[model samples]
Target: MTTVAEAASWARDLEALAIRISPRFCRLEARERARRYLAGLLAPLERKNGWQLAEAAGDASPDSVQDFLARMRWDADAVRDDLRAYVVEHLGDPDAVLVLDEIGFLKKGERSVGVQRQYSGTAGRIENCQIGVFLSYAGRHGYALIDRTLYLPQPWAGDEERRRTAWVPETVAFATKPKLGLTMLERALDAGVPCGWVAGDSVYGTDSAIRRTLERRRVGYVLTVTSGQRLWPGTVSDWVEEVPADGWHRLSAGDGAKGPRLYDWARLPFRGAPEGWSKALLIRRRLGDGELTFYLTCAPEGTALADLVWVAGARWTIESAFEMAKGEVGLDQYEVRSWTGWHRHITLAVLAFAFLTVLRKAAIKGRGPSRLGGRLDPADRARDSTPASPPPASADSRHLRRYRLVILAKTSSAESKAIALEAPYQNR
Candidate 1:
């Protein structure tokens, strides 16, 4: 448990980071909102809704939070852009990746932007929900969602009355999740956000236009595809079925809660070669389960299987991130029904998550964890199994956010105290 002085110190650090990205005119009140809202989200409360956030802010009514989200003059996009720059500055690597995935936010009414009876991955069934395409940066250090765009279904897009009620802009039009992803990708690259690859599930992977866009941008990717998705060389299923018994190698995508997620992996040849790049069908079969998952990969020639496995495993970081955001920071606990309000809440939620993420990394840096784990400097890791050194603290910031934690799998028992306290995904 964190002591009073320690928790107070945590708030001050998070406040400074939040204030850095907060809009100029709203800094004073926004800093207060940032501190209280984040505390409420990280609090023991079951629901961090508007009323709860107001309570955290010591307000008598939820009106203040409602107004702040719906009518505040601050620019949501600018804050998002600032957060992106911060994440890149701290966690970005040339070998790092930008992961894309859509998450379902369940809603009861059709009034909410993009709400409809749709296929929701969250509920694992078709339900009335709004989907938001999110982009996360996964690197050697850590991963966090950096940006998002709510997916407005065609019904909401076509209904002018509904659009007006939700405060959706007239310029906003119907776009598939992949299209939304493409928009975010272009924005990141335009801002010179550093990353080497992109990864996503078949939803975005199967889109020819999305693949073409990545190809045009010369970005590498390891996106999952259906086994039946045909390739000129061979169907993914055909290639996986034909591989010899000795062809597979046991590798881990990354360390998980239980242990290293070990799987039998193989790479297949591509018939149609991409100009100045190579494409391969990578397959992973669960240990003793025989079930297989296929990924369509585009990268440089002779890219190590470890690298491909790393990217495949790294995609799960987004899932863990979603779990943390929703459970730890009110990512989906918003009461807003308007388009502007949804974006505003989401961007701020992401900002809050970023602050927690910085603290998480700082915890790791402070603890000086064994670099022997997969998360390490590539050259040092390749040279020997020796633990890599922690980075020097940044001169621009001084402090670490304090939170309770419990350690699990692959991590050292010695780190149990600090890792549990520092890991953003460690359950607030």
Candidate 2:
């Protein structure tokens, strides 16, 4: 249950956020309406479309909200920059992981911007939908989606009539999902969004350019790749067959809803790492059927295998954020079809999601078990052949449970230049 004081604090936080972005809106009326729009996004309405949101704001019609989203002269990109700054202010950590992934918004019509028959993770199959490439910040305290790009399909990009009808900007061009993810990553790093590692699934991991860019910038990463991904002389699957049974170490990547996600793990150095940097193949095997998953890890030399596992686990943080944003904050409950309208609504939803995350972090602080960090008990370590490192002393040890993977995985930009990198995959 929400306490009155806590609710009041959330209100004030919302107001503060409104004031922070007020300058983006040229007109005072538009500024006020944006605030109401934000409030409506946070409201517990069944649908977050223009009608429902305006009704919740005590308006006779959705004209105000719709106008704010479509014709309102505010720059959505500017508001997004504010969202990024806000996330950093509250949840910034040096060990934070910047995660990139895409979600599909299922739409019925062909007129929606970027709508086409494509594979959407939301539906788990090819569907007519708009794909959104998103970047989320996952810090020790909490996580939130901070940046986004709508993937304009090649056909839509080439169709001038459709593009003009949807009010797509001339400056926008057809870019692969990985390229868009790369652009967002570059933007965040340029804006000084503090993070030590990057995590993504194969959509990003398969793009060698993305990996090279991170390497040049000296950022660590744990990106997933397919078993068939070649590593010089042989494929990853081929190398897996050479590993002795004793080479595998049982480890918990991180805690999930059910509990610690334990899997058999093995790591081996890969050739062709630049001088001072280390590259390795980290493989995970399911306990039940020995199913295999591979990760390409890049990090500073001497990065522990446990730390790579921790970073690999961090990729799921974005998935949970997507679920929360859509289920609680109406991230997908938009009725917009135009490019500007889509951006405006999504930006506001992102704001509302960030607000809820901050409130939840405050509500749970010092009250319950830490969500990500757990102390590994001796008995848990006893399952592995080699004894793990001594657990760090934590004030929350009383709240810490067994089988939790605990490590900072902190890497400096300077240190990252000489580190090995890892990779993971997005849900296809």
Candidate 3:
């Protein structure tokens, strides 16, 4: 485990990086204000006396943190673009897989955008919540968030009063998560990000529009599909000729001996399929666990088998990213009610997580201790030649020192002064 000092140092380093990425982040009334907001979320620090977590983070007052976030230009789109550029410049490999996924935030009330009695993947049951569609860039260098969209419920978008109350823009409209995901892909491609192929789950795979869009853009995709999804074996002409005048037939296949019957199989191009549909492979696999699944892809006609398998497997990275962000990095722990607060909190959480990820990778590669964890290591202290005594200790003394080092190294005398303007909220 990392020492307290080391953890605090890491937090400071993360704050500095956040400032560098968006200087406006540091300009928020107090310097440590933003740092405290992030540290409280990232570290397992206990709440301070007389300060509620929300109040301490500046979310209580009128000109509060929520308002600040609402007025800022650090919206989802801008943040996504900045992070995308960062990943490309610092993390991208020549061959990288762009992973797209949507995570649903289970909200309790119906007022928030897209909060309906619907299925939330997060809760694994029907619940009221906002769903966020996200796109991520993942490869050996590191993973960085690329895009996100708040799925507005039809009621919120269709009602002018509710829309105004939520501060949702007039142009905001209802669109399925998959549709929003497609827009994210288009934006990334328009920016000239070097993405080789796209990978997603059955939700995206089942959407003919998404698959066709990829085909239209000449982008390769490896997407999972339901066993019932139609596919044309060999060629389109073959399927067209085989279908009777009454269209296609759904064949019944047995799940087991004297067992439940299900669709055996069939591959056909989408009905009324548009032109430019690339020749894609239809594949099925029987896992060692006895689960059967299918996938569709257009990974060049004769690509090596190994390369095809690798592309198909890349989608798991996004899942891992989501798991780490929510579980380890506290992605869903914000207690805000406003849309702006939610967005800002999630963005900051993403940045904090990304910084830690970069640091961990650097540490593993023997690049030295992370700037956020201070320049010292517990292991290093063990090797010191000074006469040994009972090791220095405090509940949070180690972390406090590391945090101080990071702040000192990243914030200059002038920046420190600017940060100090917020006074009492500096550090507690």
RMSD of 1: 9.0
Q: Name the TM-score of candidate 3.
A: 0.68
Question: What C-alpha lDDT, on a 0 to 100 scale, does residue 405 get in candidate 1?
Answer: 19
How many angstroms is residue 374 displaced in model 3 relative to the true structure, after the best TM-score fit? 17
Give the winner by TM-score.
2
Tens-digit lDDT track for model 1 on 1-428? Answer: 55686567676666666566656336577656655665676667778899888887789999988887888677778888888987886676665678999999999977788899999998899999989999999776678899999999988899989999899988899998889998998899888887778889998888777788877787778898998788866577888666665567666566678756666678876744456567888988775657889998877655556567777877888988999988778999999999989998898788777767766776766632121112346774454322233222332111111111122222111122221212222211
Q: Candidate 2 on 1-428: residue-level lDDT in tens? A: 76786567667778878999999999999999989999988888898888999999899998888788899799999999999998887676666789999999999989999999999987999999999999999866689999998999999999999999999999999999999999999999999988878999988988899999988887888899998898878888888876665567666666676656767678888876655568999888776677889888887765667777778888998999899889887889998899999998899899889877876665555322222123334663354313234423443221111122543223211122212222221121
For candidate 3, what is the lDDT? Answer: 0.56
Q: Which residues of candidate 1, in runs, are more than 4 Å off?
A: 1-5, 24-36, 271-276, 367-428
Arranged by lDDT, best first? 2, 1, 3
Off by over 4 Å in 3: 1-12, 24-35, 46-67, 70-76, 233-278, 369-428
1-428 in candidate 3: lDDT tens per residue?
87797666666666665565554453555444556655555665353211344465655553555444465454444555666665565555444567778787776776665567877776788777777777877654556666666777777779887777677777778887788888888888888887667778888877888877877676667787776676654432234344333321122111223322222122322333224323444342232232445567654433333333445555766766777778655676655555566666677667666766767656654554443333335674344323222312433121111101011111211112211111101100
lDDT, model 1: 0.73
Which has the better TM-score: candidate 2, or candidate 3?
Answer: 2
